[model samples]
Target: MALSCGIDFGTSNSSVAIVKDGTVGLVPVEGDHVTTPSAIFFQRPNNTVYFGREAVQMFFDRAGGRFMRSLKRVLGTPLMTQGTLVNTRHMQFGKIIAAFLQNLKTQTDVFAQHDVLNVVMGRPVHFVDNDAEADRRAQEELKAIAQSVGFRNVEFQFEPIAAAFAHEVNIQGEKLAIVADLGGGTSDFTVIRLSNRYLRKADRAADILASTGVRIGGNDFDKDLSLSIIMPEIGYRSTYGEKHLEVPLHTFHQLAEWSKVNFTYTPKVIMQTRQILHQSHDRKRYKRLLQVLEQETGHTLLGAAEQAKISLTGQAEHRAAFGFIEDDFFVNIQRREFDDAIQYEVDKITASATQCLNQASVRREDIDLVILTGGTTEVPLVQEEFRRMFPKAAIADENKLSSVGLGLAYDSQNKFGDGQP
Candidate 1:
């Protein structure tokens, strides 16, 4: 049997899937969850380490360790060139990513009872939109990590294209479909033609008509929601000193975001925050910000915001209570409030989808199906955009979380099993 697996090293979650007996399926990475949160924590005292759920749980347990999430966001950026210090040990973003990929390989190997050396990795349409060199650099960085983890043969597939292949299996007739992949850190779109007949053909280059993406996704939503709703309670807009100058907002901005949270932990930033706290008019709010810096609880606060965003998906309103940051600290966020906060992103996604059609020279009426993938598509606002854009098209509903991974597995089978690379 070919020991190949499809790896979706997503911004918020990661998963692995394999093709066996002509069937593609997901391999559980943590417990029964095929997709685990893409997070890691280096524990203190003895320097123990954890990945995925345990890593998140360890941080929540207040293990006094270094917690890093959205590690993928560092790729294709200057941050990858300069490593960050974790637990007093200097490590590059590539090394951290390799650690996570290595863990995925170990888990998949144990599940498959063999060494999986070949992989089909999924990537967004563009890691850094319009910058070909940066996008290429991101892929090279990811490919290097894959090789370091023992994947001797590695191939890349656009995440939305991979998803289309998964969706193709269910299509009975020829149709034009648009794939909207709203991931944690990027939103990708692909306009392609799919059919049972096309599935049997080995070549699909011509079928993929147009592809476009933007660096906007669920994480951005979390940031904006945090800024609009959560950050204000923590001294985001307060003034300081007799001059009535606005309090420094950079620290609050970093605190509201996950990828930038670690960067704010420097001594200079801490000292500056302390100075602001001492000179602040609203000591209570600045003190809360100080507590976040002191306790290293930025992740926990963002996690709460993320949870509130998720909860607002099903309910009319949700409350994010940050008792850890401050006693009786809470923010009641209504669905409309969350929608308004993230409308900018929602507009970008809408424009990207329309751009895909225009680039392909395919009219909106010509689209036969609109496929939604990735976790963020669950939001009502996101869904509403798709509905408005492709009002006449039939929507193929697949497992949003696993579609890309599952599709990559199918691509792996086509690449390795059929000897057609």
Candidate 2:
């Protein structure tokens, strides 16, 4: 049997799927989860490398500068200064990404079974329009890395297009559909015409009305929650009694990273805050008790605040304790408050969707289906916004999220014909 694989190298999480026996399915990781954490950690003292969940778990333990996450957003950007080093403090962007992909490859089941793998990966459409040069360079680098890892051929597909193909299997007739992919690092939209089961077969099907993206997703919301709810309770300030509050800033960033990893529920971020305070006050033993109180109070306040937000998605109101350190530091956040926190992002998504509809010269009623992909779509506020924005169209199957990788895998096999020798 020939082996071909499709990979969704997403900003927040990554997954690989394979086509076998004419059926496309997800390739399970060593631990049985189809999705792998999109994290990379470079460890010192032993020169060890970590990827996926293991890397994410080790993030807080490692120095922030040494552990890298969300480099996918930096793709097609100058966010990484030229010649800048990653963990080990001496490698450039190219090397860092290569290492991450290489580690991802090793974690895949196909690599173990196939002598030569045919791989198809997904990229955002904005990567083409906004940063063509950087996008092209990144593609070349990815291809080189895949080839080096024993892949016979590698190709890239627009993420929304890949997602649309996944959706095409179930839906039929001459119809227009909207794909709203709200991933961890970015959100993308694609409006396409689907007739029969084929995509891009004729000039009409090949037409792309509008595609737009923004660098906002679940991580951004977590940051907003942390800033508005947690930091203040911890007595955190940019200036803390003469010394710059650099440690609290670092702690806040760390909590954002932590939020991305542990998305299932609000994590107990108190320990992380404690570690920060301990390190920050290491020089002054007399201030240790105060630092501990600040850390505890901050975590309690932030933890309750985040829980409330998470809860408000399912409940109208959620009550949480905010003042473990100071009795007066309690705060209550209603569903409306959480909604207000994310209103800016909600507006951006709606505007993008409206612009896309206008660019397509299609009325909201013309859209036959809407597919919601990405973790952010799980938020009730986002769902309600999309529903309000596109009331005429029925949302496409919620089951489409897992199928993106499957379609990409099938496409890989069809496009490359099993990586024949």
Candidate 3:
């Protein structure tokens, strides 16, 4: 017997599902939670590792080690081949990905009472937008990682299309639906025709209209909030020297990036910051910057921005604190300011969704339903954009985090049945 399973290795969160005898199911990868945060923490001295919510909590609990989030965003880039020192040994990123996948596979094994081999993995529509070769390489690399982790066979499904499948099972009549899956690392869209007529069809190519995506996502919003409201207090725009020349801002930008934050503590960059600190006209701001680097608090500082972004999802203002940087350090962020900061990213996401419709020769009013998934859709500004576009279309209630995984289970059932390979 074979276990046909699906894995949505998302940017911010992840889930696993299986199709058994036409029934879909999930195993609690962490405690009672089917979905776990896509985070990893490595505890020092022993190099012991933790994943998901536990990893994040350990990170904030002052546990000694390295923390990494948004690992999915690094897949299509050069960093996928790079390595970082976990303890005394350098660990390649490909191995890191395998480790995470292996953990999930272990859970799948226990759920099946045997080794589960046939699997499907979800991928964003555009892993690296506008770069076809790079996109192909990214998919190949991911497939290799899954294979390395003991999967006998692996297949890929576009995330938004997978989400579309999850919605297709619920609708009755024929409808032109748009699926917008905005995750922590990318925003993806799919224009498709959904109906019960095609519910069990294995090939959805003729039903799907168009698929498009861009790399801007929730992490970008976190970065913008960090740079605009949090970085200034840490010498981002402060001046130095008799000329009062502005201090270099590249390091602050790096700190704002989830994938590059660790690079901020490199000896070369730290030395450069100190050289400028000596000439700072105002040492207070630069001192705070130094403190962040010395403590390797890049993730903690950005966590404040992320929390503020969530807090402002419904309110007008949020005061984010960075006591980790200094005692009583707080920054008040207005909703308008947060919206203004992310205006560029918002516009890009809007344009990508428009591109999908245009590619399919579909119009706003032509759509019958708008299926929204992924956590970033919770933001007020992002919600408003969709409302204005598909004013006449009804919004489908989506699972946000696990829809793709659930849909992929259906896909797995279609591609690989109940028999052993």
Candidate 4:
């Protein structure tokens, strides 16, 4: 028997799903966890690779090696073709991504007794916002990568549209839905009519009214929050030298950004941070920054920021611990501060959602349903934006983290379930 699955290679987390018989189901990518963090950690000595939670855990445990997350954000950028050091060996970003996907396939093969091949990968509406050429290249590169990983038949569906299909699984009648997939790397929106009547139809192009996305998501929020709160503590935008001029900000930006953290571990960056530490007004802050650079704890620092952002979703305040950066030193981040920090990103996401509806020429009131997908939607501010737009629409967050993968599986069933594998 042949096994086909849908791969949602997300920025913050990833999932794999398959359609067995007529029912769509999720694959346990991480020891029974349907979803796994999109992270990779390379252990030292042998440079063996680990994925998902284990990867994150190994990195945090100071298990000597390289750690990387948010690899999906590199697609469509020149960095996709660039090489970086994974331990002592240099590896291209594309290969790192392929290793991750290959792991997904290997795990699937284990589940299916070594019978898996065809795949439908879920992608954002726009991988590189505002640049058609880069976006096209991104999909091309991804397709090639997927094929390299033993996916004999590969296809793609816009993530928001995929979320719509997942929502359609338990829906009734007809609904004019605005599917908002606020993921880690990007936030995508689609205005589409969802109905059980069209489930069997292979072509949903007619039902898709509009699709639009912005290159902003949970990771961006993490960056903003880190810059606003955490980075400043670690000498970001701090003054140095005789003129009291602010220190160069290039290093700090990369340090706080989840995708760019590992890039800051170069020898050049370490020396640069050391030079900045020399003229520091307050040696303590830059001192820690230098330590972070030298110790290669940039990822851990950014993870603290990401955790702080997630904690703010359910609580009014969170203490962003930086004990790794220092001894028992942490910052109290209030919800209001987080909201203020990420206001710009939230506004841009809202604008994109409105733009999607405009591209469809559909009035906001007509969207009777708002299907929310991806972990970013759990944020209070992000959710509030969609609610403000579609006040009357029913908001559904069924399986926010796994909807895209599950929907892609349904899509695969339609596209590949013709009679034979």
Candidate 5:
């Protein structure tokens, strides 16, 4: 017999799900964890590769190696075609992605003895935001990668719609559901008509009303927070000239951003920073920035920023200590500060949700249920925004992390039933 499963290749994490014994179940991707961090760590000395949690640990523990996360964000961009040096070996980003998915296939094969070929891959509503051509190309790139990794019959499903299908499984009555899938790189929203009556249908095209997405998510919040709270200590807004000319900000922005961190490690950027520091009025902060670059602690700094962002979601205040840059170097961040930093992203997400409803010709009150998925939805402000938008609707977060994968599994079952080997 052949096995068909759902793959949610998220920006920050990844998961696989399948319908086993007539029930949708999450298949552990790494060490009994259904959702695994989307990270790849290469050990230079042994030329070994690690995935998920082990990969993250290797990244933090190893001395010199390449650690890549947020790989999905490179899709449809020029970076996808560019190769990078990992352990002195040149590897294309596409091949790295394929290797990761192939590893996922190997892991799935361990517990699932069947020859798995059919797959339903979850994707954001708009991979490249408003650019339809780029978005289409992104899907094509992913499909090619899936095919290269042994998935023979590949199908695509909107991530938000997949989450909605997961929620629809237990819903008894009819509902006009809005799914908010806030992943690491994108925020997607979908309005759908679902019910026990529609659950039995083979296709759900008619049930889906509108889908909208934007290139704003958890990473944006992390970047904004880093710029606001962390960058100032390292000369982000400091002066350089007799006229009090502000220091250049492009390099600092790149340093604060996760995807751009690697790009900032080049010789050109280092030289530019040195030139700025030599003439900087705020020499202390620029020296700190120079040390950060020399130490290659960009990932560590971004990690601190991400932790602070996560901490602020539940608590009023959080302190991020950057001992890697300087002993006793730290910054205290509050929830309000976080909110202020990420207000632009949150506002865009809200606007996207409103656009989804408007596109569906539905009123906010008409939305009977709001289903939240993806890890970023854990943020308190996002939750409050949903509540404010649909005060009457019941907000559901039952499948916050696994909804897309589970829904894709449900979709796979509906589409392939028992797939052919």
Candidate 6:
């Protein structure tokens, strides 16, 4: 029998799955987690680029314009601008995706079992009608990329539809499900109805009556956190000459971007900051003074900020320490304050949900289940907001994260039979 695979090329993370012996299993990448980070890093030293975790780690590796993380946003947009020089960074988006797909293919065992690989990829429904001409061109470009990556048969299904299919397989009922897929760069919601008899007999096809999306997710949250907490405490002067004493806010912003994912060790970060400050003062004798201040102020402040965000999810109040910079550098942030930080974005999400419901002519009570996906949904405020909106409906099982890829794998196995010889 032939082997088939399903790929979830998500904006934040990507995963591949295959079915064997009538069961779906996620394909592990390099003995690590099943999902790969959706990042790319260009290394000038070797004139090569890296993808996945390696790329994410090298995000701030002193390479000039060598990192691109959110290229998915421009999938359907034109790559060229009048009078602008184009480089490898300006290469077509589809080709970049194809490169990632190629890397993924090389990592998995899917190619050995089947002479012709059949792949089902998840795409957002919003792309289907994005300015007809541009949308068609984008779809064509994506399809061509798949073909280039060696997939003989490539199929695209709306992401929410795939999530619904995944949800339907696990729960046996005749009811409506709301899928909230909050990925890295975008969040989409879709309402779907499922019936076991309908699915088993292929008599009823699941319908996506309404769908909506916003180009906001976890990355936005990280940015907001950096702005509200880290920037102020760093003593990063924005209004000054371009000297050691006068660092640009933009430079700190770039540093914050790097610090978000890197700089796991607090002491290392403190020491690094102290070194920078000492250099700024132009006095080698003050190096120890800078180190003492950093240890007593800077590290504590940043660490507390991150911890507060994490604690606010489960606790009503959280205090972030900032003693590294000053004696009274502490900042007390209540859960409410954290929620307020993301209030506007949460409102947007709620509004999007309402619009989807209205478009489908379905009331909140009509939704039988709500499936929450992505990391942002883990936020307490987001969870509370969604729960209030869907109090009556059961939040679909939390396992929906990998459900789409699993369903695709199951569908592939059924379509192609077992992989056994």
Best prediction by lDDT: 4
After aligning candidate 5 to the native by TM-score, how far in Å is the CA of 249 from where it should be? 1.8
| Number of backbone collisions per candidate | 0, 0, 0, 0, 0, 8
lDDT of 1 by residue, 95-156 (tens): 88899999999988888777888899999988887799999999999999999989999999
lDDT of 6: 0.62
Better of 4 and 6 by lDDT: 4
Write model 4 residue lDDT over 1-421, tens digit each, in one string: 3667899999999999986666678889999898999999989988899999999999889999988998998998989877788888989998999999999988877776656778899999999988999999999999999999888889999999999988896778889999999999999999999998888788888999999999999999999999998888888888999999898898889987787887887898888778878889989998999989888888888888889988999999998888877898989999999999999999999999989989999999999999999999999998888888889999999899999998999898898882133
Model 5, which residues run further than 4 Å from truth? 419-421
Q: Write the per-residue lDDT of candidate 6 for residues 315-412, one digit (tens) a residue.
A: 98876654444456555667776777778878887787888899889999899999887666878888888999999998865654566676566556
Residues 2-43, candidate 3: write the lDDT tens digits. Answer: 878889998889999887766777767788899999888889
lDDT of 2 by residue, 335-388 (tens): 776777788877887787787788778888888888888767877899998898
Clashing pairs in 3: none
Q: Please list all clashing residue pairs in model 1, or write none if there are none.
A: none
Name the TM-score of candidate 4: 0.97
Please list the C-alpha lDDT of all candidates, in the order they appear. 0.88, 0.63, 0.88, 0.89, 0.87, 0.62
Pairs clashing within candidate 6: 296-323, 296-324, 297-323, 297-324, 297-325, 298-324, 298-325, 301-322
lDDT of 5: 0.87
Q: Ten consecutive residues with minimal summed lDDT in candidate 6?
A: 80-89
Of candidate 4, the 10-residue stretch with the lowest lDDT total is 412-421
Candidate 3 residue 329 Cα shift, in angstroms, is 1.0
In model 5, the clashing pairs are: none
Q: What are the runs in model 2 whose C-alpha is more than 4 Å off? A: 59-66, 79-89, 109-112, 127-141, 199-207, 235-312, 316-333, 418-421
